[model samples]
Structure formats: C-alpha cells, structure tokens
Target chain A: MRIVVVAGGVGGARFVRGVREEVQRHRPGSTVDVIVNTGDDWWLAGLRIAPDFDSMLYTLSGQNDEERGWGRVGETERVSAELHAYGVAPEWFTLGDLDLGTHIARSAWQRAGATPSDVARRLQERWPLGVTLHPATDEEVDTHVQLAGDSAGEVRELHFQEWWTRYRAALPAARFVQHGIERAVPSPGVLDALLDCDTILIAPSNPVVSIGTVLAVPGMVEALTAEAAPIVGVSPIIGGSSVRGMAEACLSAIGVQTDAAAVARHYGLRRDGGLLDGWLVGLEDATAVDALESEGFAARAVPLWMRDLDTSAALAAEALDLALALRP
Target chain B: MRIVVVAGGVGGARFVRGVREEVQRHRPGSTVDVIVNTGDDWWLAGLRIAPDFDSMLYTLSGQNDEERGWGRVGETERVSAELHAYGVAPEWFTLGDLDLGTHIARSAWQRAGATPSDVARRLQERWPLGVTLHPATDEEVDTHVQLAGDSAGEVRELHFQEWWTRYRAALPAARFVQHGIERAVPSPGVLDALLDCDTILIAPSNPVVSIGTVLAVPGMVEALTAEAAPIVGVSPIIGGSSVRGMAEACLSAIGVQTDAAAVARHYGLRRDGGLLDGWLVGLEDATAVDALESEGFAARAVPLWMRDLDTSAALAAEALDLALALRP
Candidate 1:
C-alpha cells in the first residue's frame, strides 16, 4: 500500500512517526508520503522559520523535544535574552540559542540551493528516517489572521503568531486567510501522490488553518477527489476539546463547533463528491455515527488519542482499516 | 571648523577616538565627519557586518573592546561553538555573543525600513558621541584579494577578517579589487563634509584598502581638490611595520613599499594632481622632509606613535596645525 498523509505540525508529526513504524512492520511493502503544511512559515530576524515543516522533520528525525513536542531539546536562551535587550524583541516567540543553530543552517543551506523538502531530507539524514516528506508547495504562502479590534470595522492582518500567541485568541477574527495560495501550485510529487495513492489520510490536525491551507493550494483538492482510493480524515477535535492546542480557535474562526461530529461535518461527508471518503471520530463520540452515516459517508469511532508510540500506531491502524474498508 | 577624517577599521577607530576629542575641544563649532571604508563589509550568518563602520561606531560610543580593539566586551562564545559544530567554523574571526547583538539589531532595524544612516543615528543617540560617522556608501563594496597559492587561479572572496585573521595576511596577493565600488555612491555627508571641511585629516590607516577605497568613491577625490582646505594624510606605516594589522600586506598587493614615505608617495605628492596638500610623517621619518618640500607638500615630522590617548591627542594636534597652515 502507498499511503499519503496530509499533515499539519506536532500531531501530524507524532502520527506520521507511528505510521512509518506500522508500514515497516505489518504493511511491509507500504510507502509513506507526507504532504506537510507550510502555513506557519514566517521570516524572523532576517531568517525564515518554517515551523510546521521543521516540527515534522525534527520529530521524524528524533531530534524534537520529547517533553514539549515542539522545538529542539537542549536549547539555550542566551541569544533570546540578548535580542530582547536590543529591543528587536518580539515578546511572544522566544528564539532559543541552540534552536537558532538549526535555523541558521537551514537559511544558509537554502541560500546554497536546496529546497525545503531537500533540506528536510538532509536534516532527516541525521536520524536516517526512511520516508518521503514533501512541502505542499515550494512557493511562499503565509497564513494571516484578519482581526477586528476594539474599534468596530477596523481590521488588520496579524501574523499567525500574534493571533495564536499575543492575543491568546481573544481578538474577534474577521477571517483567516492563507495569503498567496491562489498562486501556489502543488510541488511536483504532490498531485500524483494524491491522485495515484492507495489511500490518503488527513492527520488529526488543524483544519481551517493548517490542512485547510494545504488543501487551498490550487488543484490539490481536485486531484485528491479524483483518486479512486479511500480518503480518510482523523478528527483533531476529541472528547469535546482539542486533542492538543489552538484548534478550537481555528474551528471557531470558521464557525464550527468544537466537537468530533462538527469536525466531521466541517470537512463534510463527501463519499462521492469532495476530498474525504472516510471520517474517523473519537471512540467517545460514538453518538456521532448516526448523524455521520446520515450524511452518506463511511464513519467509524476509534481511539484517537496518541499518548505514546503504541497508542499512536494503533490509531494509525484504525484509520487505515477504516480507509481500506471504505474503498473495499 | 568642519573636519573630515578618512578611516579604515580598528586602528583607524583608535585615531578617530582621539579626533573626536580634538574636534569637540579645539574646534568647538566644528563637526567631525568620518568617511569609513566599507570594503570590509560581508554577510555573516545572513546579517551584514561593516567591520570598519562598526569599529568606528563602537569606539565613538565608548563601548569598544579596548584590549581586543574589536567586538563587544563581556562577550560569550556559545554561537561560535554552535556555528563550528555546523561545519561553519570560520575559526579565524570569532563573533562574540554580545557583539552579535549589535549586528542582529542593525540588521533587523535595516530590514524594518531604517536606512544605514538612520540606524547609525539611532545607535549614536544612545552614546551621544561628539562626531559624525558614515559608511563610504550605502551600497556593499567588498575588498577581494587575488592570492598566489596552491589554489592559484581561484579568486575566492575573503571577508576582510579572513584575510586579517584566518590567513593572518599569510597569503600573497596579485592585486586587490574593490568589488561593487562602481555601483556605489558615497554615503550621506561624505562628499559634502570633504568639500565644506575646514581641514581634512586622513587617519594613519591602511592606505590601499582603506583610504584608497574611500577616495575611489565617485567625485570624492574631486571634492577634496575643490575644497580650499589642505588635505593632510598620516601614515599607517611606521618604523617599517604596520602600526597594527595588514598594512604591509595591503601595500604589497598594490606593489608599494611598506614605508612612511612610500605610503605618502603612493597617495602621490599631488595624487597625479588629485589627493593631498600636505603629508604628516613620524619623527623618525623626519629626514624624508627634503623630498617632501620638493614634491610641493609641507611635510611635518610629529610624534605619530599613538600608544595611548595622550600620544594620539598630541599627534592629532600636530596634524590639524599642518592642515591649518596649508589651507589655501
């Protein structure tokens, strides 16, 4: 089986780590292709930081902070403090000293003629991670949040971090925009993998902001829907709350309820029409099955929590089984 | 009185420190404007560093590394170690952690719409230095040396530090090229200060690479010639050696002898009827005076050894008096 997973950041990274293990074991001939979201890319301190791409890369490479699940471990804060003293400080994101090493390496490598996926693969070489990961597109499409402040009718574009960090999601967002997506074409391998895959899985990740942004790339959604295989999407919303962070703010921005059924509904049961062929809701949200099947889609209730390697592997298996059955 | 001083890097930075005191005390109404050589500019870790400009800025601010006469004090080396581990080990020139802060700030500010002059003024505001400083140009003009080595026929560009530190000027050069100077315009206040100045005091800095590069700016030499004030140059070469670094190697690159008279002669008695009106030599080079008058320049033999503040200030006084006497 050739499995293509549309992934965001941490949750996607963790899920992919487990998926790679399963393919090597039970599904020995399976090839894993990760379509990574690039919505969180931003240029900081004259160096570009592709947060989502790096998170997935670092996690797969085993260099990611196991405790925090983001950023590299053994990070130092001296550079951040010095930057602060100079008053170029962005109060929200603290750039650790050791973390800057990776960024510096990436920026220089990119300048030396390497693409994002190429650089990620080179970074992955340190761990010898044998999997194909591709940025959805090579172009720069930044995700910006338009927010309405104290004065009504006043709207300004906030860089994603400001919406997610400084405001802590309190600002009333007029809309979320993946700016420049209109010009963004999928990377070379993207459309073919989406169209020719045995199964396509959407990792339980931010929908409106991340996976949504990736799908917004022109022709990607159309290509995925044209595939004959089952298209399964794992729910990021579990047990009436986010399985991780900030997905609720994003869901709310799109006016979706923060629940498994609403997540499935937001994606919408599209067995014969759109991208998703099968939708996996949390086992705790079993009540969602009747409504999901009513919309004429393949729906299953499974353990969606990915607390450890085994649990995550089991979750991947559940989603794959659902995808296979739906196609079968 | 308005005084224009032509300068290079740290050695010139020291002389400039003394010039600041002289301009403020003796020529109270006079403003000191320095034409700093930008031939040493290079991009390090994605940030532009103008070593000579930075040295002048730090020295004038009273924040100079007195012992090292370069980077910031109380500096750390964490980033250098990190960079080394990344195979970016430019072992020759060490970038101290605290010193990196200035580079970061300037880069960030410049990227955020501040011009080089605007950034300099902002930096100077904190220090309230007595004089004005300007990079030779807003454009980047780097000095590239053609060396005769095993890698002969390979014209690799070395950031000024690499030549001064990594190779320690050990590489023999065919010639020095001021790359990008053709595209450059003199930085704000450079030509005007030279034209309107009461006197022009050329610091005893690297002539070929430093003062020569400044004079290479379009119409700068013409502006000096047009000014009624005499142009006085202090020799960087002293007692058959450079007062500090690379002056001998730099002179050899231009095929000039490493002696005070040779340096003055290299600038030319009239710079082919262009540059200096008077030349100041050290007390030891007093015998070279007869040749100087014949060359149509009133040469002065002063105690030009700047071992400390007192020695540097006395040297500055003698050069100014010569400049005053030679004024048309």
Candidate 2:
C-alpha cells in the first residue's frame, strides 16, 4: 500500500511516526510520502528555517529530541545565545546548534536556485528514512495571522511563528492569511503522491494552518477531491482540547469549537465539497463519531494519545482500517 | 591624533592590539582606523566569512582567544561537526559557534542592502572597541592562489583559505590573483582614513596578501603616498624569518626573499613612488637597517617580538616614534 500524509511540525511528526511503523508492520513493502506544511518556513538571520520540514526529518531519522518534541537531539543553543547577545530580538524561538547545520545546508541549496522540494530530496539522501518528504509548495506561502485586537485601524499581520511562538497565540487571530498561496503550485510530487496513493491520511496537525494551508495551495483541493483514494483525517482537537500545539486557539480563530466532531465537520465529506472520506477522533470523544457519520462520513473513535510508538501505531492502524473500509 | 593601520588576520590582529595599547598608554585620546584585508573573505555554506576582519574585531574587543590567537574566547564546534555529519567537505577551517553569530548578523545586514563598512560600524557599536574597523572594499575581492603544478596545463585558482588552510601553503603558488579587485572600489572611509590620519602604520601582517591586497585598491596607493603623514611599516619578517603566519611562503609567491631589508625595498621609498617612508626592523635584523636607510627610507632597529601587552605596546610606541621622527 502507498500512503500520503499531510503534516505540520510536532504533532504531525508524532502521528507520521506511527503511520510509518504501521506501514512497516502490515504492508512490509509499502511506501509513505509526507506532504509537509511550509507555511511556517521563513528566513531568519539569512537562514531558511523550515520548522515543519525539519521536525518531520528529525523525527523520522530518529534524531529528534523526544522530550522537547521539536529540534534535533543533543542540540546546543550556543549560536542562538550569541545571536541574542548581539541584540537580535524575537528571541523566543531559538534555533539550536545541531539544527542550524540543516538550515545552513538547505539555505545554501535554496539560494543556489534549487526548489524547496529539490533541497528536501537532497537532505533525505543523508539518512535512510523510510518515507519521502515533499514540501507543500516550492514557493513561499507563509501563514500570516492578522491580530483582531490591534487598536490601530490598520490590520497587523504577524508571521505565524510570532503569533504562535512569541505570543503563545493569546492575541485573538482576526484572520489567518497564507501569503502568496494563490501563486503557490504544489511541489513537484505533492499532487502525484496524493492522487496515486492507496490511502491519504491528514496527520493530527493544525486544521486551520497546517492542513488548511496545504489545501489552500491553488490546485491542492481539486486534486484531493478528484483523487480516487479514500482520505482519512485524524482530528488534532480531541476531547474539547488540542492533543498538542495550539490547535484549540487556531480552531477558535475560525469560530470552531474545540471538539473532534467540530474539526471533522470543518473538513466535511468529499462527497459534500470537502476533502475527507473518514475522520478519526479520540476514544474520549467517541460521541463525536456518531454525529460525523450522520452526515455522509465514515467516522470512528480510537485511543488517540500517542503516548508511545506502539499506541501511535495502533491509532494509525485504526485510521487506515477506516479508510480501507470506506474505499469504493 | 588619528591613526590608520593596514592589516590581515592573526599577525595583523596582534600588531593592532599593540597599537591600541600604545594609543591607550601614550597618546591617551588617539583614534585608530583599520583598513582590513577582505581578500581572505569567502562564502562557506552560504555564509559570508571574513577572517581578517573578524580577527581584528575579536582582538580589539578583548574577546579573542589568547591561547588560540583566533576566534572567540569560548567557542563550541557543535554546528561544524553537524555540518561534517551532513557530508560538507573542506572541513579544514572550522567556524566556531560564537563566531557564526557575527557572520549571521553581518550576512543579514549585507543582504538587507548594508555595505560591508556599514556592517562593520554596526558590529563595533555592540562592543566599546576603541578602534574602528573598515574593509578594504565593500565588494567581493577574494584572493585566489594560482597553483604552480596543475596537470591540466592551465593554472588552477583556489581560494586563499584553501591554499593557506587545507594545504598549509605547501603548494608553490605561481601567482596570486585578487579576483574581483579590479572592479572593486575602496569601502567607505578607507581612503579618507588613510589620507587624513596623523600616522599610517603598516602592521606586521603578510605583505603579499595582507598589506598587498590593501594597497592594490585602485586609489589606495595614491592616497597613502599623497597623505603628508609618514607611512611606517613594521617588518613581519624578523631575523630572516616570519614573526607570525606564512609570510615567507607568501613572499616567495611574489619572488621576494624573507628578510627585513628586502621587504623594505619591496615597499620602497615613498619619494620613489612606493608606500613606506620609514621601516621598523627587529633588533636581530639590525644589520639590514643600514641597507634600508641607503635606499632613502628612515630605517630603525627595534625589539619587534610582541611577547606581552607591555612588550607589544613598547614595539608600537617605537614604530610610532619612528613615524614621528620621519615626518616632513
């Protein structure tokens, strides 16, 4: 079986790890392609920092700090500290020393005129990672959050990182705008992977920014709904809260309640002009499954907390089973 | 009093330290402006690494590693090791963590349309570094060494770092080419500093690459000759050998023997359209002083080995005194 997962950074990284394990266990020869959100990618200190892409890369390569769930293991912030000493502000999000190696390499390749996808392929060549990673788009489509409470009449657009990391998403987001999304085409293999895969899984990432930004790429929605494969979306919002990250705040920005069923409804059935054939919610949110199923969707409840690799794999396996069962 | 010094990396840095100390002790309120060689600058992993400029910056700011004689006092190579793990080659010259911070800041400023001079000024503003640092040119003018023995029948050009660091200057250089030097204009304040200074001291740096590259700037030689202040050069070569760095090998590339008198003759008499009005040779090389004097240069013998700050200051005071005595 071939699987394609749409993913963000931390939570998506954990979810994809489970999916990779399930594929290795059940379909021994299957391939997995991850289409990662590049909306969080930005140029900081002349380095192209792709937070989501690096998180996936480090997690898959077994080099991610499991405790922090972000950045590389055995990382140092000497360079970051030095940058701070030089009075570079926005010091909230730190780039670790070991992580800088990847950014330095990627930035060099990107500045050399190679597309983001091309650089990703080159990076993946370093490790025997079981899955292929493709950026959502080669072009810059950064997610800018327009703050609702800006006293000035003019809108204040904050880079997704500033809003999410520095401010912890406390300031209400008036609107989430994926800058340059209209001009962004899906990276070379994104559309092909989504269409050709036997099953498509939307990892438990931010619905409004991660998956939403990916779908917003010009032809992405059309390609997903047109594909013959069944699409399963694992809810990031579970039991009236986010399992990881600030998905609750992101959902609130769009006037959606922090519940699995609400998120599933947000990504409605593909038959009803949306991108999901099935939805996977936490067992605690089991009641949400019945409500989703009533609206032409195949929904299921599972133990969604990825406490360990085994538990994560189990959740992924359940999601895959739902997709397979709903397949025409 | 205003002083201008032409400098390179390590040796130049040490000499500049002596000058700074001398100014602090004797002149009290004198200012020193350094026109540092940018020929050693190169792009590594997309970072703009300026070895000479950084060497001078660190030395004057009292942040230089006294034991290592280069880079920051406390530096970690975690990022560099990570880069090697990612298969980056030519890992000869390591960029330490703390050092990367400066490069990161400077590269960002340069990309944001600031000149190298502007970046230097901003960097100086962070530390109460009494001296001002200026690049020889704002534009790229990397020194490329043409190897004498390339099997391709054509001279192979290499970056100065590759020739100096990787090979340790073992390969006989057929010629030295300052790539992009022709189109290069002196960085802002370079010519003005040279022309307006009360004394112009040629630091004990490599004459061929360090001081030579500075003089190669289009109007630089004219400015130094036209300036009324006596241009005094302290010999990097003492007792028929280099005091520091690979001055002997660099001199051989330009067909000059490593001797105090020969170097003075190479710079020649300012009356005969050359740079120096006086030459400071080591006490061990006092025999060459008379020969230099015969060529119309006001030559003097001094204890040139900068063993400590006190000794370095004494040497700097002697050089300054020589310039003062030779002034018209």
Candidate 3:
C-alpha cells in the first residue's frame, strides 16, 4: 500500500513519525510519501533554510532535538551568535550549528542550480529515512502575512516566520499570502503520490497556512479532488483551540472559528467542493462529529493528542481506518 | 607621521602589530594605514574570504589564535566538517566557526554592493584597531600558480591557496600569475595612503605573491615610485632562508635565490626602476648591506627575529630609521 501524507514542521513531523511507525508495523511494506510545505522556506545569511523540510528530515533521521521539537539535537549556536554579533542575520531566528550544516549543504546545491526537490532528494539519500519526502513545490512560494495596526496603524506584510516566530502570532493578522504560489506547480512526484496512493492523510499541521498553502499550489487542489484515493484530514484544531501551534490565529485571520466542526467544514467533503473525504478530531471534540457527518464527511473523533509514538501511531491507524471506510 | 604598510597574512600580521606598536610609542597620535594583499582572497562555498585582510584584522583585534598563528583563538570546525560531509567544499581548506562569522559579515556586505575597503572600514569601527586597513584593490586578483609537472606531466594551474595550503608549497612552481591583476586598480584610500604617508614599509611577507601581487596592480607601482616618502622594505629572507611561510618556493618560482642580497636585488633600488628606496635585513645578513648600497639603496641590517612584541617593534623602528635616512 502507498500512503501520502501532507506535513508542515513540528506538529506535522510528530504526526508523520506516527504514520511512519504505523506503516512499518501494520502494512509492513507500504511506502509513505510526504509532501512537505515549503512556503516557510526563506534565505537567511545567504543560506536557504526550509524549516518544514529540515524539521521533518531531522526528526526522521533521529537527529532532531525532541525537547525543542525543532533543530538538531546537541546543537550549538556559536555560528548563529557570530552572525548576530556581526549584525548580518536576525537574532530572534537563531540557527544551531548542526542545523546550519543542513542549510549550508542545501544552499550550496541551490546555488549550483539544483531545484528544491533535487536538494531534498540529496539530503534524504544521506539518511536511512524509510519514507520519501517531496517539497510541495520546487518553486519559491514563501508565505507572507499582513498584520493590522502597527505603530503607523497601517497594514504591513511580513515573512510568515516573522509573524509566527518573532511576533508569536500576537499581532492581529489581516490575511496570509503565498507570495509565489500562483506560479508554483506541485514538485515532481507530488501529483504521482496523491494519484497513486491508497490513502492520503492531511497531518495535524496549521490548516490555513501549512496545509492550505500546500493545496494552494496550482493544480494541487484539482489533483486531490480528481484522485480516487480517500483524502483524510486530521483536525489541527480541537476543543476550540489548536492541538499545537497557532492554528487559532491562522484560522481567525481567514474568519474561521477555532473549533473542530468549523475546521472540518472549512475543508468540507470532496463531494461538496472541498478537499476531505473524512475528518479526524480529538475525543473532546466528538460532539461535532454528527454535524460534520451530516455535511457528508466520514467524520470521527479519537484520542488525537500524540503524547508518544504509541498514541500517535494509534491516531494514524484510526485515520487510515477512516480513509478505508470512506473509500468508494 | 602617517605610516603605510603593505602586508599579507601571518608574517605580515606580526609585522603590522609591531608597526602599530611602534607608531603608538614613537609617533604618538599618528595614523597607520595597511594596504593588505587580496590576491590570496577566494570564493569558498559562495562566501568571499580575504585571508590576508582577515589575518591582519584578527591579529590587530586580538582575536587571532596565537598558537595556530591563524584563525580565531577559540575556534570550532563543526560547520567545516559538515561542509566536508556534504561534499560541498574543499576539505583541505577548513574554516573555523568564529572565523566564518567574519566571512559571513564580509560576504553580506559585498553582496550588498559595498566595496572591500568599505567592509574593512565597518569592521575597524567595531574594534579599536587604531589602524586603518584597505585591500590593495577591490578587484578579484587571485594568484594562480602553474606547476611544471603532474602525473600527466602537463602544466597544471592552481589557485595560490591550493598550492600554498593543500600542497604546503611542495610542488615546484613554474610561475605565479595574479589572475585579474591586469585590469585591477587600487582600492579607495590605497593611493592616498601611499602618496600621503611619511614612510612606506614593506612587511616581511612573501615577496613573489603577497607584495608582488600588490605591485602588479595597474598603477600601484607608479603610485609608490612617484610618492615623495622613502619606500623601505624588510626582507622576509634571513640567513639564506625564508623566516617563515613558503617564500622560498615563491622566490624560486621567480628565479630569485633565497638570500637577503638576492631579494633586495629582486625588488631592486628606486633609482634603478624597481620598488625599494631602502632595504632592511637581519643582522646575520649585514654583509649584503654594502652590496645593496652599491646598487643605490640605503640598506641596513638589524635584529629581524620577531621573538616577541618588543622585538618586532624594534625591527619596525629599525625599518623606519632606514626609511628616514633615505629621505631626500
């Protein structure tokens, strides 16, 4: 069986780890393809830093700092400190030494004209990461956020990282914009993964920006809608709050409420002009299941909190069960 | 008195430290300008690394690793090891973490369209270097060495660093070519430093590359010759050998013997269409003084071993005395 998972950084990485674990245990030989969001990629100090791709890569390679939930384990920030001291890079977005190793390697390849997908392939080749990772698109599709009420009382556009990392999503976000999404097409293998997979899982990543940005790539939405595979989305929101990250802030920016029912409706049923065939929410949000099912989704609520690999794998197994049950 | 010095790395840095100390003591409140050789500069991993310029900067700023005689005092090679693992950069040319900070800063400024001299000015402002530093030229004048034989027996051309660092100058070099020196012009303040200074000192650096490349700049030779200040050169060679570095290999490449008299003749006398008005050699080579004087150069021999700061300063003082005696 082939499983394709859409992922962002932290939440997505954790969820994908469970998916990989589930595939390894139950399916035994299933191939898992991960289409990672690259909208958060940015050039810092002339190095191309793909936060989502690297986060997933490090996590899968067992090199990620679990305590930090991002970056490499046992990493030092000596180089980043130097960069800050030189006043060349933002002090807030610090890159650890081990993390810089990845960026430096990727930037070297990029400068040599390798596409993002090509660079990702090279990186994965170095590790025994059983899963295949593909960027959502090879094109530069950076997410920018417009915020309201600066000191000037005027809207200002910031790189999504600045909004997310620096501001901690505190400033009222007017809207989110994928700067180059119009010209972006799914990276090579992305459409193939979606079309050929037995199941497609939208990870518990930020709905409006992470998964939303992946779907924003030209032809991606059409490919998913046309694919025969059942599309299952795990709700990032649970009990009127984000399971992780600032999904509420992102949801509110798009005038959507921070609830499982609202999020399931946001990605509605594929038969009703939306992306999901089934939706998974937290047990606490089980009350919203009937409303989602009434709207044509094979909706269910499970213990969605991924406290460990065992719990996360159980969540992945449930999502796969839902996808199979919804299959035509 | 405004003192100007032409320098490279290691030896030049040591010499310049003494020059700085000498200026502070004897010519209090006087300024020292350093015209550093950039021919040793190269692009490694897309960052501009000016070896000579950085050596002087690190040495003067008191950040240089005294034991290693290069790089930062407390340097780490984590990033470099990563680059090597990624097969992105030459493993032979290792860049330490703290040293990379300077390169990152300089590369950022260069990419932002700031000239090399402008970057140096900015760096000096951060530290009380007490001396101004300028690249000999802003142009990329990388020195390339042509070797007589390889396994293929065809003359192979290599970047000066490749020969100097990787091979430790073991290969028999046919000649040295400053790649872009033909069209190179002195950086801003270079000509002014030479023309306006009370005396010009040629630090005991490799003559054929460090000082040779500087003179190879289109009009640099003319500027020094026309300047009223006496041009005094301290010999890198002592007791029939180079005091440090691969000056012997470089001298042999240019068909000059490794001796004080032969080197003085290589630079020749100012009246005889060459660079120096006076030559300073070690006391061990005092016999060569009369020969240099007969060739129309005001020559003197003094203690040239830079055993300590005091010894180096005394040598600097002796070079200045020779230059003063040669004044018209």
The residue ranges of model 3 lying beyond 4 angstroms of the native Cα positions read A150-153, B150-153
Cα lDDT tens digits, model 1, A1-328, are 9899999988899999889877777899888888989888877776667888778877887778898768877766777776776677686886866566667666767767877766666655554665678888887888899986668877788888778767877777768887778898888767656657899999998887788888889988877777787889998988899888788878887899999888777776565456677888888888998888888768888888898888888989988888888875
Winner by TM-score between candidate 3 and candidate 1: 3
Better of 1 and 2 by DockQ: 2
DockQ of 2: 0.75
Residues B124-179 of candidate 1: C-alpha lDDT, one tens digit per residue: 66567788887777776787777765664676665565776778888886777777
- By lDDT rank, best first, the candidates go 3, 2, 1
TM-score of each: 0.88, 0.98, 0.97
User: For model 2, how does the per-residue alpha-carbon lDDT over B1-328 read when each residue is reduced to its tens digit?
Assistant: 8998888988888888899999988898899998899989988878888999998889888889999888999888888887777665358988898998898888878888888998888888888678888998898888999998757688888999999999989889988898767898888788878766799999988999999988888878887777799899999998999988788889998999999888988987888888889899999988887878887889899999999888888988998998889777
**DockQ (Cα-based) for each candidate:** 0.39, 0.75, 0.67
Docking class of 3: medium
Rate residue A8 of model 3 by lDDT.
94
- On the 0 to 100 scale, the lDDT of residue B268 in model 2 is 77
Best by DockQ: 2
Q: Please report how far candidate 1 places residue A186 from its true position, in Å.
A: 1.4
lDDT, candidate 3, A107-175, per-residue tens: 878888999989998898888698999999999989999987657767789999998899899988998
Locate the minimum summed-lDDT window of 10 residues in model 3 chain B. Answer: B147-156
